[model samples]
Target: IRQTFPSAYFIELTVRQAHYAIESTERLPPAHLITWVLPDYIQFPFLGGGSNGFSIGVIPFAIIILALVLAPSRKLFSFLALYLIPLGFTLSIPPFSWINNYLPPFSHMRGNLRWMVSAAFPLACLAAASIETFIEKGIAGREKIMRRTARGVAVFVIVLVFVTLASQFLAPRLIGNEDFMGKLVDFHFRGRTATLPASHYLEVAESAVRDIGNQLSFANAWWVIAILMWVGAGGFFYFIARWRPTSKTVLMLIAGAMTVNVFAVFSYQYHNFIPQEIMLQTPALVNFLKDHEPNPRRYRIMGFLIGDGMFREVLVHSPMPPQELANMERELLVNNTSVFWEIQRMDGLEPYRTLRHNQLLNTLINADKAGYIFDRENPNVRALTLDRVDNRDALRSVTPQEKIKDFLLQLPLLSMMNVKYIYSLYPLQDPRLTPITIPRPASIPVNIYLYKNTQVLPRIYFAERPLFSKNQGTEFLLEIAEVNDFRHTTVIECNDCVARPVGRGQPPKFVINEYRDGLLSVNTETTADEWLVFSESAMPGWVATVDGVPAKIYTANYLFQAIQVPPGKHQIEWRYEDIFMQKQKALLEYLEKLFR
Candidate 1:
């Protein structure tokens, strides 16, 4: 892990700091995090209804409370539950907040609600122990009243479980009905019509209706199948209870109930399953992009789908149908779909990125937010538009004009990263970007416009002049972003390395001999010593060799690899190899040979 991510420690520290800051700003009330007995009313309305808005649900809460009251090992289980569940929540409170401030490892933890996940095991154990104790006590005792009460309690629990299962199966179908949805719309929109004009109100209402209907339709289907499941559970429970069943028979009944419960939940969760063939079907836009840029390694593409935080705020609140939203999310090459298309993409959903790369991206995003516009005529000079207003209000209002104004693509930084093609649902108004005509796919509701970055740099280039930066913070990132001639000037993050002036000579000729995953070879002939900058991310474990001799790799342009070369034809090879990878390769080879 250390070999793969040289800056892993730094990245972790930075991420922890960022996470803490975000958590501080978006801190939930202590009661919200600690209230495991109640269902989250804001998130799970259906479940929350049973708790009278105090907890998640009454059924689950009752079981937990019963376990606390009746468990044989109540003290130990209670201690574990109380300690684990509240540990994360208390970080936000006073005395415990000191742990977050002083303790480095503990401070790094985020997502306070996740602690409840760990507490689940103890809770489950407690509940099981309580139930077992109840049964054992009733069987061992001589009193008829106690035995009768235990049997009654057991029967009640069995009935409740089956009833809950039936509800799970039936609720999806009943809620999905059009009439029911209309009622829901009415309930939500009650007393709000007086604030808006008649036309606008109608538009909003229609959009809301469609959105809710689409969500229900997508979430649940196969009403007949659900009905069958409900009937099956009810019939099985009835037959089992009616007969004087043996121990084996009762066990089978319990096992069947467990299996059905699992099946119902799994089926409901994965109801949105599309066939493999349908999911992997290449979109027309992807085909177009592939045809134009045959070699994905040379350049990258970015899709302005509803993925970016700012962009999502505008599009999500724009009263779009849920189907349209789903199409945009699944169909667009936003996250990892670029991998399937065999095309390089800069923007992706990743757990963590290199500190420098993340900083550069954040800097560009901030610049766009601030309305910092780069000159179309001269790439070096940039202008800030103070007249630009914040789109927060516009997003809330959700007009077409406002939606368009919300996004200012960071074209300059994107160009530096070798981003050639940018596709978006809405057209971008940038002078530097030229629009390309492509027929929109019929399935897609919105029009997708492709823009060609005119100022995109080559994947590999030589720079005679080197701008050395002592600082590796936001200041350095800003300096890198402000560079006009990225191809001619390279920014090196090194305090000791000597800065070289721009040499007066013809540019060096270079040929990419070979390029593949984890390996790159290039032949270059330069008139003078210059820095060879590769647009690939400068990650750890990547070793460079100049004519079979080891050479140092320096970080360039805040995120790429840069190495110095003298005036001669040299074969430079870069291979990413780590101890863990080598061991895995050896193990695989051994296994293959042994099998043979």
Candidate 2:
């Protein structure tokens, strides 16, 4: 957080690891998709990548992109409107991302795809402008460019379809005689699981492709479809060529029929989207823990997917749930499958503490990742280590590595934070882990397993004294605390905590009075000064009042909340106040109301 980089959008916690924001292959051209329903996009929810992995905003995208190439005049405006603006947000390069890196709304953007989505309107307008210019004043020499362009577009699209259909017709013979699923299974992927077999989802998905077979075999119908598109384009252009009272009606009919054709082609693209909150299926373990007597302890899950925008229960410690993040990333990043985990929310996840809470959350993780954690940044993948000193900002690389070493290297800190369980897709055979036996659910393609740690402590505990350090980084704290039993002696540099009274007149007595999402009340009886620590992500908003008087809330254990209380019976209450989240919620509500 000390300085910013040009590629800040790529590494921003909220939008990082999100596939759609970083990858723009999905929005390339309509030529890539059989479904041609190109919807206009003005804001986030840019899940352009669809079942085809290239589906989002195809229609308008194709129109905008093609207009730039096909149209002659107003090229700079077209370039700025269609190319510069959209890419300025999506690309991390100098000339492209200049606006995003400098602009206020663009800075700390929720996702890059949202920027591209913003360009959609301007690009559409550019296309419209070109159409109007051509219809009214026509390009010099190429006066019939509009009519020619329409006919050319139809022929080009028909050829593209013919090529695509040809590929399907010959795929079986060229690739393999086996069924499509068989070929897919045999192909190796690029990341850690690349050697591992393809997910069953791939098989199930490829099986669902509408025209997987030789569309050429149905050549008669294919030709008819192509003819219809050509006729429609020809008729639209034909009417524009001459003004008449009937032209408007004829254009409307052609446009309506074309819309139906496009919709029919991609009818199934949107047949399967259910909002995550409404489609809640609580994890079995989550349900069990919620029902258990000792339900105060929080746990973390890690596996094939961590934070799904549609599934909130999967990730703890994060104010924004998986589904919530997904909705944001998919829309804003324009990648439906991408998930965002933004660690630096200006709106507080919790109350502001007596101490400043400006630190980013990524410094704590020790990820040995595969795909996104490319090896180029850290050449020796085995030696890829994340430390607070550097924030180990290597999580944005796209180069696929076979395996990421010790993705959960922060287990020591997590244990101290009261992470009781680890839900992982692969077996974590690390020394500190113990497998929790459970029937693997059929929902996920990979085998989902759970592991437990015996060393993790309770959510609330009394620490002997704060281990002071000049470096308040997460990795540094863990390194210092590991020497002693971290449960009793944790590290922090906050000046609010001092050692317990020398004589220790009497061990401090701790009792919980009341607890809620944003509030904690504790009754403490202590004859000696002691530090009372609560396991939770700390921020500036969490203030403490001991015996109805204000006290400093220390940033304890590198990431938790704590306050020192004097030797006496006292009621210590902590209240949470997050204005950012409030504003975000209010804005979201207003937006929903406006849209609704």
Scored by TM-score, the top model is 1
Candidate that scores best on lDDT:
1
Q: Against the true structure, candidate 2 has what lDDT?
A: 0.48
Error of 2 at 249 (Å): 2.3
Each model's lDDT comes to 0.56, 0.48
- What lDDT score goes with residue 8 in model 2? 42
Off by over 4 Å in 2: 1-84, 91-94, 102-105, 126-154, 165-231, 238-245, 274-278, 293-411, 428-436, 442-446, 472-484, 495-505, 579-596
